[model samples]
Target: MKANKASVEFAKKVSKGTPYKFTIDTLIVDHPLKKVTLSMGESFSYIPFRVEQVPRYNNWYHELLGRRFRNYTVFIESLGKEIHELIPNIYRGESVPLDLFRLSKPLKIKQPIVRNLSKASSYRGGLSNRNIALWHSHGWYYENTQDRWKWQRPRLFTTVEDIWSMGFVVPYITPMLENAGAYCFLPRERDTQKHEIIIDSEGSTKGSVYLEKGDGFKDEEGSGYAMKVPFLVEGENPFQMGKSRRMPVSKETFSTISFIPDIPEEGEYAVYISYKSHEDHVTDAHYTVHHSGGKTSFLVNQTMGGGTWIYLGTFRFNKGYDQAKAMIELANQSDETGQWVSADAVKLGGGMGNVIRG
Candidate 1:
């Protein structure tokens, strides 16, 4: 006695984004029979069957639907008008298992909506493998001296710009960009935590030191200088939990505060400063960053953008805490009179490389 085997193969050659619909035309089988039921040596039979398949691009269609909808709304509403429509929710039928077949009855599957391209795009995957770093305007802060959640920015048109900008970025923009496949990092608090986390404090954040100069320096016992918490419950501080110091601007006497960060690796780091915003804050607050390359000075406007990490230029820093290490010093030497200078926290290590982005 001898045994025989049957084999099947499937092949298709097509370009990308081409629709494929296939159907098997014919199939045949040949076999040998040794049974004495009839005088037969070999038998050949035709097997009638059909294999039908169609491409289902649910993901691409879904993304297209969302993008088109957003574009349409923006274009229509930009003319200082409104478009209203009622979208009803309908329940689809239960899913059918793969093992089951609809032979006697018709099986219908919804195809993706196809539209002609308005413009040819090279990137089929939107923002995939892209890194985006963004931050919301400002956030709420806790004024510990007054024991209340104070608004960091001015309240304009019912809501402050801090919360207003955050309303779009956190809940809307971030998710949309992420859906398009982008890794985003906004160096602010996005959690529901009402308590403050002091990031650059002694023992709280290693390899950092804060030093103060002359008298008239006062430490504000609250966070929001180092970290920013967007949402805050009632009686809960939305500011970053940390201590920030402030002193009166000086011209004759050099009153200064310095924040030094220990660099474990010798590389380029993006310097950022966080400070409090007050009505009579110094307009020309002097800041000097001493890095491996050299000393870079920047005059920051402390009257606005409190509780947010403001980026200074990237600079090269030597490893470890030495005289040539990365250090940020704020001198209370401003031309503005009857104003105060505030210093909260200094951040490093957000740069791309040691190549300076001057």
Candidate 2:
């Protein structure tokens, strides 16, 4: 007779809208012929929102969903019935005893994703002081000159991209996050293209910090790289405040721009960088981040996804004014020569405080 052992491992921090993936490994010593069937049942204090939104014909669809899921137990039982039908071998099991596992301390750092749970319940979780920037793609645009409403994007078989995002975010996601104790802000007031969303001022971004090239950057003497003056894109300006600095790609000189952030406290923060995307932009833009743990480097593709805040990774930093404590540097050097490298804004922390959007 042989014994079998198994282990499950996952990260402690979870992001909202992001899946929490875990791995389970098992070892059956000296029992190759033996078979094991694992039946797992997990439960949380609250029911998680469905990943996919229901196709709604009217307002009644959302109301029905809320009513049906009002009772967590009933909802789980109903879900279990569907699962049982799919797999006959699976059977409902008793709830796992809590004492069997050792619970850890509550999370000490700011979480990117805020879980939506019942506020009236005994749970002390709340976001009373939190500020959330609620952004959706787009919807319909009204041309005052034409005096008619038109779709911003092409209509799909299911729904329009902008309309779907606006519908899902406004009616559902926004309210849930608000109920959980967050103060939400809508960046997109109307579907007009003239309305621009800019977060340059300190008050707008809360405690987060942003750095631009001319403001908090300098290049090496005789770097041999031509710097492009700040300019706004006629159609879609990806740069922050409709401006950014770019340099010609060169193999001769590695001209770099350092972004030093003033850390308010010692904690982990999500770093974001924005750039103007163009066809001549380099495919690989080298970036190095110096944090509390160590230095990490990343090669970003500047050819695509410009004008948006791209997440680098979460890193721990010390509280201080010193650049050694926390800094990000980007070099105008890459393997590709004919392309150009951009330097725009670097953001520390989430739009509000040290938290990030999950």
Candidate 3:
């Protein structure tokens, strides 16, 4: 049968709402001497479905299915739905619902401490001094052997606090911005909608970059052909040597462009619009390209690897200081180790730097 004809027939059968028995049979009607009989084996019994039942079958029936039976349901469901809707159905089948299929044991996601180095500064001021004071208050001393004060001993900081902050920031900020996305680690952008924002490494001299568009964005440009965004390379430089720019996306045309910039200087790089909205100030979203070969130690908890530590800064939200203090207190109360210190101790410069005299 023609593929299109078979598809039409399949759709008609699904929409008819009639129960049918699917069977397999081997023909043995004409035998040489003795007549043979053929036996039929039932494969599946399809139940007639109501229109209202379509939604339940589409949603909950997959829960009862295993990998072996999922494809069969998908094929039947696909006949009655658009391709895009069916795609989600396929994804639902692939994912095991945690609430429904609980594991025999529990799982834990460990939290770690992360520091941001991009905001570090060389100027000596209140922020830097406050961090030093806080560090000292926690029994951590500053070593001036390298002409810069470095943390000399283990310091008291909450890894869980850092992770919690990142979890909030990533999810909250990612969905808020237009075409805004975030990754635990940077990814290479193959293509994106014309208006969609993407982050990728600068292409190499020998390599080429291109953008792909979907069918919904046809007739985007004067030419009907899909648009291409190319990254030009000169000599050995991989980084782009021009001002940053944004591309436009129309209702009819959606496409992405690619380019190669001069190879980065062995460090992380991030591309983000500083402004939250057109009216907002530009915020810096960072990306790390090469993290190797540096004297600075990198700590990554929730936000991807920031930068090497240079100068630490501290900011106080006076308006919310009391609430912040209370929250920290609640967090410490739940900590297993009684050693957890109150935020007030650090805020007052006494909890971290206790100089005991004999």
Best model per lDDT: 1
Model 1 RMSD to the real structure?
A: 24.4
lDDT (C-alpha) at residue 297 in model 2: 72
Candidate 1 off by > 4 Å: 1-204, 221-223, 226-238, 351-358
TM agreement with the true structure for every prediction: 0.41, 0.36, 0.17
| Per-model C-alpha RMSD | 24.4, 20.7, 27.8
lDDT of each model, Cα atoms only? Answer: 0.52, 0.49, 0.25
User: What are the per-residue Cα lDDT tens digits for candidate 3 across 1-358?
Assistant: 2223333333344445445443323323232433222222332223433334445543432333333334443323223322223232223343322233333343231322223434353323222212111111222234545554444343347332323433443345322321121122212221111122122222222222222223221211111111123432234211112112222223222332222222212222222211011111111211121212222222223121222111111122121112211111101111122111111000110012122221
**Model 1, span 1-358: residue lDDT tens:** 1111110112122113334322223222222321111111111111111111111222222233343223221110111211111111121122312223322453231110111112143334566545578868577666778877778888788867776778888778977875564545576644332221122533323656777778888876455543334344445443465566788987754798777776767776666677887777876788887888768776666876677666555577777776555688889997878889988777675422121111
Which of the predicted structures, 1 or 2, would earn the higher lDDT when compared with the native?
Answer: 1
lDDT of 2 by residue, 58-97 (tens): 1221233344323312111123322122222222233222
